[model samples]
Target chain A: AQRVTQPEKLLSVFKGAPVELKCNYSYSGSPELFWYVQYSRQRLQLLLRHISRESIKGFTADLNKGETSFHLKKPFAQEEDSAMYYCALPPFLNAGNNRKLIWGLGTSLAVNP
Target chain B: NAGVTQTPKFRILKIGQSMTLQCTQDMNHNYMYWYRQDPGMGLKLIYYSVGAGITDKGEVPNGYNVSRSTTEDFPLRLELAAPSQTSVYFCASSYSLGGNEKLFFGSGTQLSVL
Candidate 1:
């Protein structure tokens, strides 16, 4: 079974400080990783995907096959960056046409000004 | 376009009550999903459908049922609602299941079982 683990329940950082949200997964085959963000009172939206390898809102995540990790990073955290971050792994195989996603226990980021 | 839209944005149900959460998408997406978001628990998949008339259970399917009778609508049904079921439910859709296809989510329906 594919499972996603996000170790931190809450992370606090000062404005302009660096932020890292750790995520690890357990999957046998090649996995597609994604970082989804939900700002206050807003719907969850895609921040970035590993396949794209492009940064969004100054945040980037690299998939490490050796370690089975895809950690989200930002050099300078802004107060507006505070939100709930979820790491997701969507299972594409054996879906039999009904594909779904496995999500981690999200991390609540609080960027203090 | 309206994208994915879920109706009855807020609802309160008593124990043993039943209700349906309606979801519709204007994107004509073939893949639609229903997920529940709990405090600190992220989002758990409740049900998903590849297309009209094909639905399957997901990570957390307990106490819920779904039907996709049309390509534009997927509704989630909750029978005998319980306090444990109280949470924000989101409806999403995607074009396909491969190659970095991102999901488009609705604002979400907040349900509370008293």
Candidate 2:
């Protein structure tokens, strides 16, 4: 079965420190990955996607086909960056062409000042 | 523009009651979905609709139902509510899927069943 894994349940970082949120997937074919973030009392929204390769709010994620991972990274973390991050993978072909996203158990990031 | 909107920000239900969670989008998206979020469980899709009048089951559709009778609305129905059904429900929409498409989500509805 296709699955997404976010190994860390919680991550803490000091302000201005580097941050990384790990995400791994198990799929036999090429996967379209997305990173979604939810701040305190806010709705979840898209942070970025591997296809765009665009840095939003100083965060970037690269898809590594060999490792089957798409980890989110940010340099010089800000205190406002604290949020719950989730990695999602859509295995369209594997699901008989059904468009559905498989989400990972999120990692809560707390950036301390 | 209001990307996506969900009604009843918070609701408390008694066992065996039934209610519909309303969701609507103004983006004219073709795909709509309903997902439930639980502590440490992430988001689990309950149902999805590719277009108006077409709906299908998702990974966790056992206790929920959905209908997309129009292009802009997709409502989720919970019949005979139970304590296990308590969750934070989110509504999302996208123009297309399996490509560079990204989902736009609503603020979510917090439902508690007693």
Candidate 3:
């Protein structure tokens, strides 16, 4: 069974502080992990993906195979960075040809000034 | 581009009532999916379509149905609406299943069942 877990429901940090949102996954094969963010009044959009190894909006996530974790991190928290973040894994080679995504419960990050 | 559009931004339904949530995409994406976001819970896949006239059940497909009559439209139908079904529903589309492809989501439809 493939599963994604986001242990933190809410993570609050002061502006200029470092932020980290934990995400872990259980899968037998190579996994593709993604971080998605939904800001107020905006559609949910991709923040970053492990495959690209690229940072977006000053946020970067590194997939740790040994730990089975892909934690999202930012050097300095910004008020605009507060949003609902979700960690997701793409469906890989399911039996029915139906590709579905397994997602984490999501973490609400609050950056207070 | 009005990438992915979901109608009825908010809805209220009674138990046992049936309603359809409409979703349309103009990006010509071959893949479309419906997911529900519950409080403190991750989004759960309800149904997905690979292309026109091709639909399949997802992780949680019970009490729901979907139809993809064309590349641009994929609608989710809720039969016998239950309180447990009250959640924010999102419609998403992707160009493919590969790792490089990113999903584009709609603003979402918040449904409340009384």
Candidate 4:
């Protein structure tokens, strides 16, 4: 079974401080990772996917297969960037065959001004 | 395009009551999913359908039922609602073809069981 673990339940950072939300996964096969964000009272939206290797809203997450981790990072934290961050890992073998996503418990980020 | 729509944005149900949460997608995606969001817990899959009339249970499907009669609609049914079922329910859809795998989520339905 594919499992995603986000150790931090809540993370607080000052504005302009660096931010990193840790995520680690355990999957037997190659992993496809994604970071999803949900703002207050807003629908959950995809922030970035490992395959794309692109940055969104100044946040980036590199897939570290050796470490079995994919941590979301940002050089400078902004108050508006505060939101719930979730890491997802879909079974690699069932990538295109299924839409089922294994999700982490999520970390609540509070960017204090 | 109204991407994915979930009806009854909010509802309150008493114990033993039953209701259905409706979901529809306008993007003509073959895959649709039902998920629930609880505080501190990420979105947990309840049910998923690969296509019309082909549905399967997901990570958490207890006390819920679903039917996919057509490609556009997938409804989740809850029988004998309980307090544990009180949470925000989200419906999402995606297309597997061409690597269009990002799930388009509905606004979500907040259901509280009293």
lDDT of 3 at A107: 98
- Which candidate tops DockQ? 2
**What lDDT tens digits, residue by residue, belong to model 3 across residues B3-73?**
99999999999999999999999999999999998888779888989899999888789999999989999
Model 3 chain B is weakest, by summed lDDT over 10 consecutive residues, at B95-104
**Residue A40 local lDDT, model 3:** 87
Off by over 4 Å in 3: A94-98, B98-100
Regions of model 2 farther than 4 Å from truth: none
Model 3 chain A: worst 10 consecutive residues (lDDT sum): A91-100
The candidate 4 chain B region of ten consecutive residues with least summed lDDT is B95-104
Q: A25-93, model 1: which lDDT tens digit per residue?
A: 998778889999999999899999998999999999999999999999999999999999999987657
lDDT of 2 by residue, B35-57 (tens): 99999999988998989999999
User: What DockQ do the predictions score, one after another?
Assistant: 0.59, 0.68, 0.64, 0.50
TM-score of chain A of each: 0.95, 0.95, 0.96, 0.94
What does each candidate score in C-alpha RMSD? 1.7, 1.2, 1.5, 2.1
Return the interface RMSD of the candidates, in order shown, one decimal each: 2.0, 1.6, 2.0, 2.9
Over B7-90, each residue of candidate 4 has an lDDT whose tens digit, in order, gives 999999998999999999999999999999998777888999999999998889999999999999999999889999999999
lDDT tens string, model 4, A2-85?
Answer: 689999999999999999999999988877888999999898999999989999999999999889999999999999999999
lDDT tens digits, residue span A26-74, model 2:
9867788999999999999999998788999999999999899999999
> What's model 4's lDDT at B90?
98
